[model samples]
Target: MRVLITGATGYVGQAVAVALAGAGHEVHALTRDPGSDRARALEDFGVRPLRGRLADRAELSGMLAGADAVVHTAFDPHDPVGADRALFGALADVGGRRHLVYTTGCSVYGEHAHAVLTPRTPVDGGNLRARLEAELRSAGLPHTVLRPGMVHGGDARSSIVGDWFREARSSGPVHRGRRDKVWSWIHVEDLARAYTAVLRAPEEHDGRAYLLADARPVAPLAVVEAAARAAGRTDALAFAPVEDEKPVYRVFDRDEVIDSSAARDALGWTPQESDVLAALPASFRQWSAART
Candidate 1:
């Protein structure tokens, strides 16, 4: 099948494109700068790199022409509305037969407090999830909405976990928030695999939203300590409540995990034990090499 992936320059999109191309699917990717190092990486992976942004109507319409499915992973973290609207519009033009899988964050469900978020779990996103979901349903296009938990790896600035890890190193020992607060995270590769699985699925999931995560919720304090251990920092870690943390990470300083049984049952998806802190073997190797 021919697939077009948005945010091909992003961590999730790049991994998805690589996975798709490796499986012998014709993969096309959209990027803002086809000449970027990230774009070049996509090209090296055999992804047909298309030069364009999501809002570019001319490029978007043309790109959608022969695509059997589209993975819309390109979302603006700041203002998702524009990208969401533009991408949905483009999908509508592609007709209803093609599957349009839209990527959303589990953050839309907001902080889960002490509960797990299943597909059937009640969601509260201050209308954020509702608006986007409404758009997905009314798109007049075949669609699957995916809400992935904290994506583990990306560019340095892109990885919130990486930031916390880096800060933990400088702050002496490790500083964490709500050691008991649970966390639901997904490895970039596993999330990518889930995306690919959905793309290839039969007529079971349509206009359905899925929460992508592993079996259990990870505690924030444990994660920071584990990450410290992973990075070879055996210092004692400090635990603080969300209220005391800086703006740097106070928002993400809560507990949330998703129930991916729907994804597992529907798409035959099973995530390996790739913890967020443990999933960055490649990045660790690169970081080590750069120092040498």
Candidate 2:
């Protein structure tokens, strides 16, 4: 299949491109810079980069012309509603497209009173981005929405784990908003495989949404301590009230325990990295290496 992926230069996008290409599929990666090292790295994996930004509607539509499927992982975090509609409309214009896989976050479930969240959970008023993307799936566009958990691992220097490592290095003790705010995590490699599995089996996944995540939720402080240890620091982590105006104090304040049983049963998507805490050290090493 000829798959066109948006945000192909980003942390998640690069992984997805590699996963698709590794599975013997033709991958067209959308990137603003085809000359960058990231884009060059993708070429090593046989992914051809389509030089264009998300804002370029004409370029995006042209790239979609010959695509057998689309996996949208790019969006404006601040203006997700607009970005989602724009991208979906462009993909819908491409006639006879086989599948449209939209990547959303588990935050769409919001703060569920229940400890576990399934695809069947009634969505609380959550992130606008996931909300609008879910709507696109319901609008009859042959779409499959994948709500992945807090993605980590790989050369993800901008992730929460990376932040903890950086802060622990310079600031000593890492301050967090809520020590109890626990959430499910997905390693980038595993998340990429999930995308590949769904794309390969669109006959079963089309017009459906799945929550992809780990087996359990982990506390933020535990992850922070892991980052600190990975960075070779022994500073004691501190927690502040959520009402505190400090930036670090409000870093994280949500609890998400996403369930992926449906995706596993339907698309045979099984995530291998169940112990994200154990993997944090290696993840931080990759992130640290990437930045330096």
Off by over 4 Å in 1: 112-114, 153-157, 168-174, 240-253, 274-283, 286-292
State the TM-score for model 2.
Answer: 0.91
Backbone steric clashes in candidate 2, count: 0
Q: Summarize candidate 1's per-residue lDDT along 1-292 as a digit string, tens digits.
A: 9998898787678878898898788999988888987788787889988887877665687888888888888877666787778777877776547788788776566544546777887666465765787777876678888888876754433555665556645664454555567778787778888877887773467878888888767776666666666556766776555565443364456667677888889899998755665655455444344335
What number of clashing residue pairs does each candidate have, in the order they appear? Answer: 0, 0
lDDT of 2 by residue, 169-243 (tens): 787746556567787888889989988998777877777778888787788777877778888887577765567
Candidate 2 collision pairs: none
CA-RMSD of model 1: 2.9
